[model samples]
Target: MDGWKVGVLHSQTGCLALAERGPLNGTLMAIEEINAAGGVAGRLIEPVVLDTESDENKSAELVHKLIKEESINVVFGGYTSASRKAMLPVIEKSDSLLFYPIFYEGFELSDNVFYTGACPNQYSVPLSEYLFENYGNRFYLIGSNYVFPRESNRILRDLAVQNGGTIIAEKYVPLEATKDVFKPIIQDIAKLKPDVVISTIVGDGIMDLYSAFQDAGISSDEIPIASMVTSEVEIEKMGHAAAAGHIVAASYFDTIDSPENAKFVSNYKSKFGQNMRTNMCVESAYCQVHLFAHALNITQSIDTKALRAAVLGAQFNAPQGRIRMDVENHHTHLWSRIGQIEKNGNIQIVAETKGAIEPDPYMIHHAAERWQPSLISGVAK
Candidate 1:
């Protein structure tokens, strides 16, 4: 059988490296497993890796080159919304398949992309409901200045007001800005003292924010932090002491107690290292490969159009649990898990939505709904 080539576009340097490495490693592991099991369609899968260097323009350039020159069958890997958005035009024009494996703010759907990450239903809605049900009516919002955080916090703001919760403060720092160095904003957080803090900060900025929150003597136990972007991998880099006791909501965690997860953990540790941390992105990337392989096998070909159709409605029982793609929005159905960070840099799952939640990219029920139709229609166009 002929070898099928796929491209891995990820940042090995710059801000997103910490998040990208785990997933990239997971993808490699998946490739190894597939090859061991006689490869996809009796063809060895070859991943052509390219470092985006966390530069949006560089990522776009490389993606364009990969699609046109390398003739990669599918492209995978993107950690941030900016990187994904940067590659959109290139992939669309080339009519290439891209398996994006990170969660971001909803309101995007495309025929050229297969999103295996959480959308509003898999992350934001469940998180908002969890906060409202447990903590009373005051909330604070914080994030890095970017499309994902800005859009996601908008939804949070709307949800807070809709559910009778007050947003005491909303703050954002540039991607390269450090939260610890910003004294005035730290002072403001102390002043508002909201009941809950919802953080969407990403990259190295997260360490600064959490450290500053700690230095300001704000206890997570008091004004508990419920973050959409924090994970075990980030905590490992920041140290468990900085991230300990914080609550994080996502579709997957490393500590889920299931045989599938247990084997996944064992295999991952064996392949990577005992100290390696697994997060939602890693699991999603790993699952994406297997899911793609499943679809390819079912269709019995690697034809782009056929594969896209197969992926749109594909369902699989992944290590994280059952996942299905929602045809309308091109997002995924995934179970939401809320985990508390432990001192050992591990997240312990405290609560989980019973089953996979359907993706709602347009967010039809929120005040944001007014803008959804227009945005989705434009995307469709």
Candidate 2:
């Protein structure tokens, strides 16, 4: 039995670098941990890393190279829906598995992939209830022009209107948009004065949008930019002082007070850097590797067929809490938490689900009542 080879596809240098780098770090760390502990049945897991450079087309080309040329059957990476979609046909045709670790708008599912991130029901639904309840119903929507932000906004609009909330405006910008692009949005935000600025902007644009708001002297206390994509990674990069008071909804945060998370954080910092932080992407990336290792051990084979079966109904005590891969859906059941960035760049959990919420990828089972009782208050904000 030879050592197993897996592909690590994450954008190293690009607009998405700030966002994708943490997951790459986490994936490598987890592989190291498994290999150190006597990797899958004594065969080390070899990761063939690639730099997608945050380009969707490039992501597709590199993934083809990984599978056909490199012969990697298992791959772990992907930050954006666009990249994932671009790689989908190749993955499905080759019958390989891609472990995706970023939360995204849930509308599609694939057989050749294990989704380890939160779906909208697990993130957006609970988050919406909180925002409308606490921050008020009128929301100003701004997002990076892409499928995810657009889909997420659709979900938010449905939820908002159902709850008698209103969307004051909806806007989209290019991924390469500058801070100046947000100036007009700020003007409208001030004029309309929505109760909350709901932002789904991704990549470098996140920092730019926040910075523009800060420059405009817009107080978050007056209208915080409650975000779906911003995490400690962005908060850390954007500076704690600048990122403070903004909200983020995800399955995990760096500051979750739990034994599992504490250990994960400690080991991660020790390996990466004393100051390196973990967010939803990093935590999920780390957990999926462990989950894959467990599956590999149980089946004693890396065959996509055996693994596809073994990975289902798998459970791991993740940094966020108990998480499970749904046997039927292939989407992870994950904890939901809404956090506000602190002055020190930590996302302080303000509200959380009682337990890991079920994934509703297609939103077929979605209902307003499902989110109401799931979340409970945490540290006072």
Candidate 3:
């Protein structure tokens, strides 16, 4: 077998760089580890890196170049749904595979893309149920003005109303907007006094939004912010004081307690440094590389048909828990977890599903009640 040329297409310098960098680092780390272990199938994996720079157009352009010019068959990166959509056409035309490692709004299926992250039903639905049950029945939605945030909020609204909750208000801000765009939202929160703020805000905009909330003297204790994208890294960027008491739903956290997770965390910190933060995206990227290697081993090639057939229903003991790629939808079956941001900017797990939930990207199943439990103290703030 010839050395496989892989494409690394995560943005390294755009508005979403703060979040995308984690996945890029995770992907690189896996490559290094795999190469050190005598390579995959005795063929070294070579990476051709491209900076999408958080631009959807640029993401699409670069993906086409990777497939055509660089001859890379497998691409691993795309932190946001907008970027993924932008690249979809090029991927489909070329029949190349993309290993997307971030949780998204779902409702998408592509033969050219292998989704390694949770779908809407995996995080958003469960998170909505958690907030509605514990925080109250009123919610205000805010997010970056993009495909992911918009579609995610739409899904959340449906889940909330189905569970007998109300949407007090909804708003969006440009991905690269400044504090000015968030001020009025904070003001609205002050006036409406909604039970909770469901934020789909991503990237650096999160720091601005959280800071504005604190500046307005609106504490999470007043109306806790519930989120699917806000991670420990964002909390650290927003500062402990501003981000504390907020709730986040994810498939994994740096604070998870497990022998496998501990070793994963230890190894990541040892290589990246103890201060670096590891979140869901990072872990999924790491796992995707291993999953790809296993598939390549099974098929002895990176052909789309062979790889997909080999990887369908593939199981991996991820840092979060045991996860599997659903053969039907090509989405992942993941464990759902709810965590409250602590005063120190770390997440404390408060509620979690008992096992890995099946991927329901199309939302055909109604299992929101599965993750909802009796309100626990210190969770709803």
Order the candidates by lDDT, highest first — what do you get?
2, 3, 1
Candidate 3 C-alpha RMSD relative to the actual structure: 2.5
> Which model scores highest in lDDT?
2
lDDT of 3 by residue, 83-141 (tens): 89999999988888889999988889997788999988888877877776677989899
Best by TM-score: 2
**Better by lDDT, candidate 3 or 2:** 2
Candidate 1 lDDT over 1-381, as tens digits, reads 568788998889887777789889889888888999998778888889999998889888988888889877699888778888899998888788889999878788888998898886568766776677677779888888888888898888778887788888888888888665556777887888887888988888788877887888888788778898988877887777878888889988988878988988899999889998788898999989888888888887878899998887788777788888877667888888777788777787766766787777787754444223222111111
- Writing each residue's lDDT as its tens digit, candidate 2 over 1-381 gives 678899999999977887888999999999998999988888999999999998989889999999999988899999889899999999999999999998988888899999999888888888888897788999999998988999999999999999999998999999788988989989999999999998989888888898889888988889899987988888877887789888899889888899998999999989888978888899999999999988999999889999999999999988899999999999999988899887777787889888898899999875666766546556666
Write down the worst ten-residue block by lDDT for model 3. Answer: 372-381
Clashing pairs in 1: none
Model 3 clash pairs are none
List TM-score per model, in order. 0.93, 0.97, 0.94
Give RMSD to native, each candidate.
Answer: 5.8, 1.3, 2.5
